[model samples]
Target chain A: MHIDAIQTPAVLIDMDRAEANLAMAQDLANDLGLGLRPHVKTHKLPGLARRQVALGAVGVTCQKLGEAEAMADGGLADIFLPYNILGAAKLDRLAALHGRVRLSVTADSAETVAGYAARFGPEAPLTVLVECDTGMGRCGVQSPEAALSLARQIDAAEGLHFGGLMTYPPLGHGPETNDWLTRAKALLEDAGLASEVISTGGTPDLLRAGQIPVATEYRPGTYVYSDRMQVAWGHGTLQDCAMTVLATVVSRPTPDRAVLDAGSKALAADTCGAPGFGHLPAYPDAVVTGLSEEHGVVDLSACTRKPEIGERLRIVPNHACVVSNLFDRVHLMRGDEVEEIAQVTSRGALT
Target chain B: MHIDAIQTPAVLIDMDRAEANLAMAQDLANDLGLGLRPHVKTHKLPGLARRQVALGAVGVTCQKLGEAEAMADGGLADIFLPYNILGAAKLDRLAALHGRVRLSVTADSAETVAGYAARFGPEAPLTVLVECDTGMGRCGVQSPEAALSLARQIDAAEGLHFGGLMTYPPLGHGPETNDWLTRAKALLEDAGLASEVISTGGTPDLLRAGQIPVATEYRPGTYVYSDRMQVAWGHGTLQDCAMTVLATVVSRPTPDRAVLDAGSKALAADTCGAPGFGHLPAYPDAVVTGLSEEHGVVDLSACTRKPEIGERLRIVPNHACVVSNLFDRVHLMRGDEVEEIAQVTSRGALT
Candidate 1:
């Protein structure tokens, strides 16, 4: 179905903009000679991931064990589970995935490393990357000595191989990125080991990706689908936004207020205290004051161009990543036509 | 699958509590000699509605046109659409629904009444009810005269029937409800119309439902699946809550903070300014400090216990109605075992 004919409150991806975004990232990586391992958590659709892979993406990175499983099932040859997979259930799934795909995952503890080693022997080896805390206090080993020791222990595991050192840096370009990687490489060499792939990430530092030394790869997912929040953070322009939510004004309760069919169920509440619910294409200054399950509370006072009842409008959500998880299907639209139906393969695969 | 065996971030419905909640509401209506038409929007699952129907519920009420259509598809004989059906799409669906089952819908304006009349003729009548604005200035006609005029327009239409008048007042126990309904009923009689039903609804005021004079029916959906918010509102206790989101702490980023697998995708963003993402049944004081799409940020500093990364948690979300719309399927749990799975009909069905 076309954009106008399809039901309201459906996710619409502009394929032309998406292709432009893909080409922009691939071109940047080509110029810098960096391996592009795009994070698939931002857009869980296998069709979009396949387009990225076709555009010379080296591999796809997963945020969870469940996401990795879906990726493998979607015929993804290279997979990277960036989170620490804890519990017997998750480790077993990881082990099975490793046997099926060229898989690698990160870890920061001996307890977790030993658990993986015991589950899968050296013959059915899984690549282990020691996650370093390069400033984002969310995960990984704190110091170089601690990280080196953990890497040594992980490398010595019968079933695991020390693939590399990776750090998901804080959302900015900092000196810690250089100091930590330099210190980490020295410590690994001192222990007679190699940090084969020194990977660093974060969209805030993506533009300055080439500045980080000894980095073999860069992974940025949201750069391909710029959102209002991303634009506010100076990541991309409104012109770069590829995905938008197509909604209709279902309820015109008042002259100043109109409610759209798209809500938290379709938009996915991943707001960082933004101005509007989604960036209104026709009225950019409108604020989404409130949201019900199937209703988007829009405050059109800023724009003063009130949308009439049954009026169709396009909205770019605050965060594109969260919106992908809310829908099982998204229309890949080009101009007036729907090019294809992209299934969000691992959307809500939060095991 | 049992609670422990099922994957994390799954929707769970305690059948015992659900049945108890239903029984309490049924008994309340029976003792008061009132007709109970439970709203299906809270727990879109038909199995729950079936149980309520078996418990002597008169019919079911739906908020949107799509929900009423879904209830009709599930073999529900009577349904009420309590919102204004504005658009041609919704109008067409409302007309289509009249062919399948006995349907009643509310309209606050003459424009809306004319639209409904144009769709369904007298053979398949679109029963129109005047929505009264008793307290909240969200929707509905302002005064009894406006309601009377709207009712007259519906009664005079070729394909419409002036069913009655409906009012969803703010949760309270007072004489204002009696005054509003009394004035509304007098005006309806003056317009030469006999209102068949005076449908009133409010879970908070269900106990005081008898205060309204000559009201024939009441709609209370949340009573069938009590939530933590309902308990906080003094409607029920924590022991009465039937629905919960079972999630696991996937990340323990800090000593005081951990992240659960359930986020906006499962719990939704329908706080209405509640305390946290949800209440932790096992740990009462622990609060969900923040929420991302797939990460429910929890702070355990004030609580007596700490959550392990893999430990399962049962979260009673702030609003039960919005939570049901998030999941496509809900597992019916008895004690520790899962009895069956009920598909969430009308999930993403935004007409």
Candidate 2:
């Protein structure tokens, strides 16, 4: 089937662009002498994870245990979950998954480490990384002393092995994050703990991963399918975006406004600090001013030429990761032809 | 299984509260002498649509053709889709669905009427309502004259019947919307065209449906599962909210901050013009400050108590409809016990 034959409000992945993006990121990581562990949250396709692994990615990064399970079922060998996994249900799943593949997870608090310690045994220990808050302030230990304290807890736990340090640093704060990690590494070394794998990630500062000299692995999720946010942050151009929402101009309600079949459900509601919900590559001047659930209201007042009703258009959404999760399957396009329709193996694996 | 056994980041539908909300809305429409056609976009569960129909709903309203198809497949006899049916693919699907169920759609332009006229035939004439703008500034005919003009076009079409007028009016403008529909109905009467079904909808102003005396049918989507937005609009209270996102407190990175396992992928990014992304009924003073793809950050500075790690909490999202679209299945809870795990059949039916 051709790309045009597919229904509107469908997700289209340009395989050519996606392959090029994957190759570029891999090349950058190889040149910097770092392990590239691509986060699978962007595409959530095991086939793409395999492609990254084929291109020499160390493993894959997953945000949720369900996502990690899906990747493992798809034959992904090494998986790293940089999240604080809690509760008995998820811990049981984690232990079950641990028997199948090489699994490692992160913890920022002693309570999370205790849960892991109680779940696993020394027979096949789980690798636990200490998540440091290197200025991101979302999750992770507050200071180097706290990082050392958590590392010591993991080291002492019978069923857990202290893997290393991990941090999701803020964009453009490489030097500061580097200094913070340096302090944490020094503190860990002083306590007779080896910080073997220092991991840091964020697509905006992915190419500059080497700035943080203590980092051994770089985890970048959005680089697999760079979005409007990546483009806006100067990480790439619009041409580099691999995913685009195929939509139709359903209604031209007014002279200045045209509505598309896609809305927040299709393009998603994550804005890249931009003026519109998405970027229409064909009509760059057109701004998607508003979005209801199923109607993307495009402001065509600024454009000299506007789309008519029934005309199909492709939109590069604000965030690619969230958009991937919104759909069940995505069309892999080779130019205008449909190469394949791949299921998003972990589309709604929120747990 | 009990409600506590369900995993975190799960959508929980309180069936007790939902049945009460459905009954209240149906009773309101009955008292007002209006046909209650509840929109199924909130739950997107055919079972709920059946429940609404059992409680005296005239039919069900759907935003997309796929949703109407899902409802129809689940034995919903009457389905009203208040959206423009465009393109060859959708028109074909719409025609196929129309053959199985009583399907009516709305159109604002002659172009849409032409599409319906091309596909539908006199044997199974489709009902096409003229969608009026009525100050909403979304998809609709601009003026009452435009509504009449479109209605005349539908009446003139060989394969379509002029149903009436439909408007998704702005909230708190009941009298103005009533006057606009009154003029349009009068114009249709002057042209010897009877306005059979004057349909108007919006949950925010649903209780004021009687204020628009010209409306013969009232469509309320979110009232089935009232949300933070509904409560914020003074439509209902937090107790009336039937759906809540069950999440786990995964991290407490600071003294005044905590993080949940649910984020945009689970709870969604929509806000009710309120400060937080959601409302925690158990902790009314806590505010959801921010959300990443997999983490909902909470600001607990104003609260006297804070949630500990590994704790479970139920959050009422800002918008119920979008939250329904985010999950694949929802847990039906009768107070503290789990009733059933219902599938969100049309969760991502954007097309």
Candidate 2 docking class = medium
lDDT of 2 by residue, B1-351 (tens): 898798989999898999889889999999999999999988899998998999899999999988998999899999999999888989999989988998899998889999999998999899999998898888999998898788888998889998999999999999999999999999889999999999999999998888999999999999988999998998989999999999999999999999999988988888776788999988899999899999999999999988999999999999998888888889999889989998998766567
lDDT value, residue A104 of candidate 1: 89
lDDT per residue (tens digit) for residues A241-306 in model 2: 999999989889899999999988888788786788999998999999889999999998889999
* Cα deviation of A146, candidate 1, in Å: 3.8
User: Which candidate has the top score in TM-score?
Assistant: 2
For every prediction, compared with the true complex, DockQ reads 0.38, 0.80
lDDT of 2 at B200: 93
Candidate 1: residue B52 lDDT (0-100): 81
Each prediction's total of clashing residue pairs, residues at least 3 apart in sequence or on different chains, is 1, 0
Measured with C-alpha atoms, the lDDT of residue B259 in candidate 2 is: 92
Q: What fraction of the true interface contacts does model 1 reproduce?
A: 0.23
Query: Looking at model 1, how many pairs of residues clash?
Result: 1
Q: What lDDT, from 0 to 1, does candidate 1 have?
A: 0.79
